[model samples]
Structures are given as C-alpha cells and as structure tokens.
Target chain A: SAVISQKPSRDICQRGTSLTIQCQVDSQVTMMFWYRQQPGQSLTLIATANQGSEATYESGFVIDKFPISRPNLTFSTLTVSNMSPEDSSIYLCSARVASGGRGIQYFGAGTRLSVL
Target chain B: AQRVTQPEKLLSVFKGAPVELKCNYSYSGSPELFWYVQYSRQRLQLLLRHISRESIKGFTADLNKGETSFHLKKPFAQEEDSAMYYCALSNSNSGYALNFGKGTSLLVTP
Candidate 1:
C-alpha cells in the first residue's frame, strides 16, 4: 500500500484566483493521477502525471485550467487556474505502486476547495 | 469507449438486512472491475477488486461477464456500512486509467 499526503484539507477561495494542491507519496511511483469530485457527485479523472513528461489530461479537462507538475517520482502538484464556482469540488491525488504482489492505486485524503 | 453504470443513485436498508449495490459496465473486451467506498468523513478507498475474488468487510462481489454486471452484496448491513459506493473499470489495454460509475449512496439505518 502507498501512503499519500495532500495539503490544505479544506479551503475557501475567491473566484478568478488559482490554488495549487500538493501531493507527496512515500515512495516513487510510475503513475500519479488527479481527480475531481463535485458536491454529492462521483469522481472524474482530470489528468495523469508521469515524471519528466507532460501530463495527459482526460477529455473535457485542459492543461490551461489545471496544470500539473511532477518534479520527481514521489511528488506532484495540481494547480487550478482561474477558479470559479463550478470548480468548487474535492480534488484528490492518487498514486499507483506495485505492492503485495499486485499493483494497487491508493488515494489521498483530498483537498476540498470552495470557490465563491 | 469504456463506461460504467450504477443503476441506483441511493440504496437504503435496515441494519442486519441484506444489501446489494448494482453495477454494470460497457467495454470492448474483458476489463478489471473494482468496488470503492467512501465514508462520510473519509477519502475514497478500495473495497475490493474482481481479480482478487475476496470479500471485504463482509461484502463480496461477483463479476458476471455474460450479464455484464458486478454487484456488491453483504448478508447483513451495519450502520457503519453507510457510504458512497462506486464501480470502476480499468483495461490495461487502455493505459490503466479507470472509468468510474456515477456511484450509489448506501444508507444503512438502525
């Protein structure tokens, strides 16, 4: 199992501003993913960050709105640029590591952002 | 395109009653299926995966390929079992990224 730490468990941000959420893993991983969950909704994949390369975003998500940086195998950051009320949601960071004879993906506690 | 579907948005059962959360999927080929759960104050966590064929917290699921379903079931529901449940599918052929369902909110009342 992988231990992931995410900062700013909850925050209230004004619209038009940006916020960066950090994710740190206990060990190096091949894949790091960012997800978003709106209030009372399910999670949706935002992007995939692999160290030393550009992040691959899913359909409907763009790098301009959510830029990702993976400086190293164990650390990654997601910045929500030009926030809006629609961007108010729980952002989660997950990492995949080979463990217990299987590759498993574990998630962080998530950072809840309420954009006004 | 890969898609997951959770037919029910909400499922309620009394404590000690049986519970089942339905999940269906659409994929070109065989895919990995998993169940995830999230408590009110906790992060989303993996409950079990189809390949593992294991039961977690008395909950077990069987992947029926012909039926195209993986339903989560437990004989007795506990109040602690109340959580948001999601069904997900990941095909290694598709780069291991998961396609998740809309999710079902389970409420076990005492």
Candidate 2:
C-alpha cells in the first residue's frame, strides 16, 4: 500500500478566496483522483489527474471551478477557485496502485475546507 | 453511467451481534466493487474488494452478479467496528474512477 500525505488538513477561508490543497504520494502512481464530500453527502469525483496530460473532470465538475495539476506521478494539487459557502467540504486525494492484477486506491486524510 | 447504492444511512448493532451492510450497483460492464471504511478522525481505508475474496477485520463481501449486490457481513460486531463504510464501483467505462455510494454509518454499542 502507498502512503499519502495531504497538506492543510483543515482550513478556513473567506468567501471569494481560493485555496489549493496538495497531495503527495510516497510512490509513483499512474493515476490520481480528486474527490469532494459535502456535509451529509457521498464522495463525488472531481477529476482524474494524470502525469503529463490534462485532467479529466467529472460531469458536474468543471476545470475552472476546480483546477487540478499533476506535474508528476507522485504529486498533485487541487484548487478550489472563487470559493463560497457551498464549496466548503472535505477534499480527498487518492492514488491507485496495482495489486493482485487489480488497482487499489489509497486516500489521504483529506482537507476540510470551511468557507464563510 | 455507473452508480453505487447503500440502502441504509445508519446501522446500529450490539457487540457480538451479527452485522450486514447492504450495497447494490448499476453498471453494464463487469463491475469491480470495493468496501472502504473511515473511522472517526481517520482517513478512508480499503477494507476489502470483491475480487480478492478475502476477509479483512473479520468482514466479508460477496458479489452477486445476478442481483447486482455486494453486501459486507461480519458474524460478530465489535465496538471498534463502528465507522462509516462506503461501497464503490469501478469499471473501464469511467476510466476506473470509483463511483461511491452514500456511506452507511455503523454504530456498535457495548
């Protein structure tokens, strides 16, 4: 299993301000994913970040709103732009590793963002 | 579109009692399912996956292709087992990104 570290475990931001969360993995991974969990809601995929390519955003998530950067295999960053109260949620970073011919994902502790 | 469903929002069980967490998924392709658990104040971790057919923390889940369900079960529930469990599905169609269900909060009391 791969260990993951996320910076800014918790943050408080004012409305209209932006915050970027960083995810660092111990080992190189092929794919990294970003997810958001709102209060009392399921984890929703924000985007898929691949090294050396553009990110693939999920249906309801747009790059403008949630920009992602995967500069390398071991690190990725997700930025919540133009933040609002609705954007306050827990953001998680996940990396996939191959095991038993299947891919298993490991997650970070998550960054809890509170926008006021 | 792939979707994972966990019917119960919360499940309470007494220590040493049997426990089951229900999960169902909808997908056209062969689905790969996983059970992830999040303890209080901890990161989400993988408990088990259907393909492995191995039990972790005395919990097991079997995938029923006909009924499209994968339910996690344990014969004896412990107080430490209380946590939020999420059912997820991943397939090639969605680029292998997990589609997670609304998690179920398990409460095991002494």
Candidate 3:
C-alpha cells in the first residue's frame, strides 16, 4: 500500500474563490483518483488522474469546475474553481497499488474545505 | 458500473456483544470488496478486504456472492471499535475507482 499526503489539511474561503489541493504519494503509482465527501454524504469519485494525460472526469463533474493535473506518477493536484458553499467538502486522493495480484486502494487524510 | 449500499447510518452495541454491519453491492462483472474505517481525527484506512479473508482488530467480513453482500462482523465489540465504517467495491478487470457506500457510524458502550 502507498502512503498519501494531502495539503492544506483544511481551509476556509469566500465564495467565488478557488482552491487548489495537492496530493503526494510516497511511492510511484499508476492510477490516482480524486473524491469528494460532502458533509453527511458518501464519498463520490470526482475524476481519475492519468499521468502525462488529461484527467477523466466522472459524470456530473466537469473539467471547468474541477480541474485535475497529474504531472507524474506520484503527484497530482485538484483545483475547485469558482468555489461555492455547496462545494465545501472533504476532498480525498487515492491510489491503486498492486498487491497479491490485485489492486488495493489507499487514501490520503483528506482536505476539509469550508466555503462561506 | 459498481455501487455499494450500507443500509445502516448508525449502529450501537454494548461492550462484549456481537456486531454486524451490513453491506450490499451491485456490479455486472467480478468485483472486489473492502471495508474502511475512519476514527475521530484520523485518516480513513482499510480495515480488511474480502480476498484476504483475514481478521483485523477482531473484525471480519465474508463475501457472499450469491447475496451480492459483504457484511462486516466482530464477535466482541469494544469501546475502541467505535468509528465510521464504509463499504466499497471496485471492478477487478478495469481500473475503475472504488464506489463507496454511505458510512455506518458504530458506537460501542460499556
């Protein structure tokens, strides 16, 4: 399993302002994913970040609103553009690692975003 | 597509009692299942996976393919076991990310 670190652990921002969240993995991994956990809600996949290529956004999510960048195998960033109160949630990044002939996913601690 | 459903939002049990957290999933192809836990102020971590069939922290989950379910169970609940548990599923053939269910918050009292 890979260890992931995400920053800034938490933040408060005004509406219309954007925030970029960073996720770094201790080891190189092939696939990385971004997820959103709205308050009292289940975790939802936002996108899949592919190294050296544009990310694949999930349905109901758009590149214009939630842009993702995967500069390499171990690092990725997600930016929430034009923030709104509804966008406030805990954002997590996870990776799929090969273990015992299967893929196991591990997640970062998560970034708690609060929009006012 | 894969989807996981955890019916209980909260589950409470007294210490030394048996505990069970129900989970059901839907997927067209072979799927992998997992249980994840998040403790207060702690990061979400994997508790166990169906393939391994191993117990962690006295918790075990058996995959019932016929029922499309993987429910977590612990023989003797402890106060320290209280936490939020999420059931997740992923496709084995593709790189599709995990689909998680709404978590169940477990409370074990003395």
Counted clashes in each candidate structure: 0, 0, 0
Task: Give me candidate 2's TM-score against the actual structure.
Answer: 0.98
lDDT of 1 by residue, A1-116 (tens): 88999998989999999999999999999889999999888889999898878999999999999999999999999999999999999999999887555566789999999999
TM-score of chain B of each: 0.97, 0.98, 0.95
Local accuracy of candidate 2 as per-residue lDDT tens digits, B6-80: 999999999999999999999988989999999999999999999999989999999999999999999999999
The most accurate candidate by DockQ is 2
Model 2 CA deviation exceeding 4 Å by range:
none
* Candidate 1: pairs in clash: none
Task: Please provide TM-scores computed only on chain A for all of the candidate models, following their numbering.
Answer: 0.96, 0.98, 0.97
Pick by TM-score: which candidate is best? 2
Task: Identify the runs in model 3 with alpha carbons over 4 angstroms from their true place.
Answer: B92-94
Fnat for every candidate: 0.61, 0.93, 0.86
Give the CA lDDT, 0 to 100, for residue A55 in model 3. Answer: 92
TM-score of chain A of 3: 0.97
The order of the candidates by lDDT, greatest first, is 2, 3, 1
Give DockQ per model, in order.
0.74, 0.94, 0.86
For candidate 3, the iRMS in Å is: 0.8
Question: Which residue window of length 10 is worst by lDDT in model 2 chain B?
Answer: B90-99
The lDDT per prediction is 0.91, 0.95, 0.93
Tell me which of candidates 2 and 3 scores higher on lDDT.
2
